[model samples]
Target: MKLISWNVNGLRAVVKKDFVKTFEELDADIFSIQETKLQEGQIDLDLSGYHQYFFYAKRKGYSGTAVFTKEEPLNVHQGLGIDEFDDEGRTLTLEFKDFYLINSYTPNSQQKLKRLDYRMRYDDALREYMQKLSVDKPVILCGDLNVAHEEIDIKNDKTNHKNPGFSDEERAKFTELLNSGFIDTFRTLHPDDVKYSWWSYRFNARKNNAGWRIDYFVLSDNGKKMLKAADIHTDIYGSDHCPIELDLDI
Candidate 1:
């Protein structure tokens, strides 16, 4: 099975920039998107062969997520069971017969670190939610996690240490998640690969290749061995972020 995840930045904007064509070319069995930045009736996307599921933020033109799958899931749930976190429409859980696929748009800590405390609380809550799901079945967690997990994840780690997405506290929380039994599928497949998925729109960063590997597809240990291939679609363009894909033998 092939699965792909991307933070399109904004679905409405990207669709006009060839998003539908790109989506078709990727040909994934399941494709998940974060940061849709749209609400109901805002845009009409025709995904002929896929079943679409969306979780929209209560706030218009803000954080949102969607999943388009060739096969319909047995069940789908929005949010992580906390009303506070759910209000942002940051998470969507799809239960298949064999595992749970979670697509998330993790909250950014903000440029000034203003949202740091809330992000920390979100980290704890997300961990608990993933763990609880793991008890029932293996989980495939994917999307823009919004944190550069380690020095290896960003080009200029030293300079970015205090930055919101690259801060030590945020990275450590990602570490904590990995230590809890989830494996970053891309890293596992390409241990030495140094490519990035998200880049800053500022200072011509994308052109210069100044980027951070913040997006991910993390699989539970039980699902790790099923991974066939993992890749980042660096050449695909539309958003500041590119797509990350995974293929599992199962």
Candidate 2:
């Protein structure tokens, strides 16, 4: 199964930017999107042969997530049941026969790490949530996790050490999550690859290829056994974030 994960930045905005053609060309069995930034009824996307599920934030034109699967899932869950986090509609889980697919848009710590504490709480909750779900079946978690993870994951790690996505606290939480029985699919498969998924729209970041590898496809150990290939589609454009993909033998 070929899975695609992308933080479109804004679904409506990307739609007008050849997102349809890109989606068609990728042709993934499951396509997961984060930061959709739109409320229900805002955009009508006709993706033939796919079952679409969306979790919209109460705040209009803000954080949100979505999944479009060619095969219908056995069950669908909208949020993590935590009021603090649920209100933003940051997560969506689709339960298939073999695994649970989680689409997420992790909260940014913000400039100066003002929101780092809250971001830590969010990370802890999500990690526990994934662990709980893994008790029944392994989870395939994918989205813009909002952290660069390591020096190798960011272009300017030295200068951005304390920045939102590159902060030590955020990176530590990501490590804790991985230690809790999950694998960062792309990093594991391509250890030496200097690739990135998200870039700032400022200072010609994309043009210069100065970016952060914030998007991910994380899999539980059992699910990791099925992982075949992992890729970063840096050539694709529409959002500040490019699309990341994972292939599973299942």
Candidate 3:
């Protein structure tokens, strides 16, 4: 089975630019996107042979997530059950026969780490939520986690260390999650390989290959056995963030 995750930045905007063609070319069994930046009825996607699920934030044109799958889910869940978090439409889960697929758009700490405390709470809640789900079934978690966990994850780690996404507090939370019986699929497979999924629009980041590996495909330790391959599809372009893929034997 093939699964793909991407932070489209803005689904509506991408739809006007190569989104349809890109989706067609991917042909994934499950395709999830984050930061859709739109409410329901804002855009129509003609994705034939796919079942679409969307979670819209109460605030229009803001944080949102969506999932498109060729196989219909046995069940669908909209959020974390926390009003503060759910109101932002940050998460969505689909229960398949063998596993639960979770797509998320983690809260950004923002400039000067203004939202750092809130983001910390979100991290803890998400970790607890995923762990609870893992108690019943394997979990495939993916999306723009919004943090570069390791120095290797960012092109200029030294310069970005104090920045929002690269702050030590955020990175530590990611480590805490990984330590709790989950595996970062791409890192587990690539080890020392250097690649990034998200790039800054400023400083010609994409052109200069200055980016951060913030997007991820994380799986429960039990589900790691099913992981065949994990990759970053940096070549595909529509948003500042590119798609990451996972191949599972299951």
TM accuracy, model 2? 0.99
Candidate 1 regions exceeding 4 Å error are none
What pairs collide in candidate 3? Answer: none
lDDT of 3 by residue, 123-182 (tens): 999999999999998999999999998999999999888799999899999999999999
TM-score for each model: 0.98, 0.99, 0.99
Clash count list over all predictions: 0, 0, 0
- Per-residue lDDT of model 1, residues 10-101, tens digit only: 99999999999999999999999999999988988899899999999999999999999999999999998898789999999999988899
Q: What would the C-alpha RMSD of candidate 2 be, to one decimal place?
A: 0.6
Tell me which of candidates 1 and 3 scores higher on TM-score: 3
In model 2, the worst 10-residue window by lDDT is 160-169
Q: Of the candidates shown, which would achieve the greatest lDDT relative to the real structure?
A: 3
Local accuracy by lDDT, each model = 0.93, 0.94, 0.95
